[model samples]
Target: MAVDLNEFKHPSWITAAGAITGYLLILIVLTVALFIVPWLVFLAL
Candidate 1:
């Protein structure tokens, strides 16, 4: 699916909030992965 970037140009605050939310979500996933990966590796051994 293709999205038009022009459609997203109207509201600046919404865009900024979305960007921040996406960034924080990614940060949280990575942080959880850091803890989970080691446990998985240890289980495999």
Candidate 2:
């Protein structure tokens, strides 16, 4: 499956902002999980 960008329109500022916000949200969730999961496992032991 090849990605074709020939017909893709350039993203506006709003689209760019949305993508950035989404990325940040994902990073934050992963970071929180990474930090909290260790403690959770330790507590369960």
Q: Please provide, for model 1 over 11-38, each residue's C-alpha lDDT reduced to its tens digit, 9 standing for 90 to 100.
A: 8868898999999999999977997888
Worst 10-residue lDDT window for candidate 1 reads: 5-14
Please give the lDDT score at residue 25 for candidate 2.
100
Global lDDT of model 1: 0.88
Model 1, TM vs. native = 0.56
Which portions of model 2 show Cα errors greater than 4 Å?
1-11, 43-45
- The candidate maximizing lDDT is 1
Over 4 Å off, model 1: 1-10, 36-45
Candidate 2, residue 9: Cα displacement in angstroms equals 16
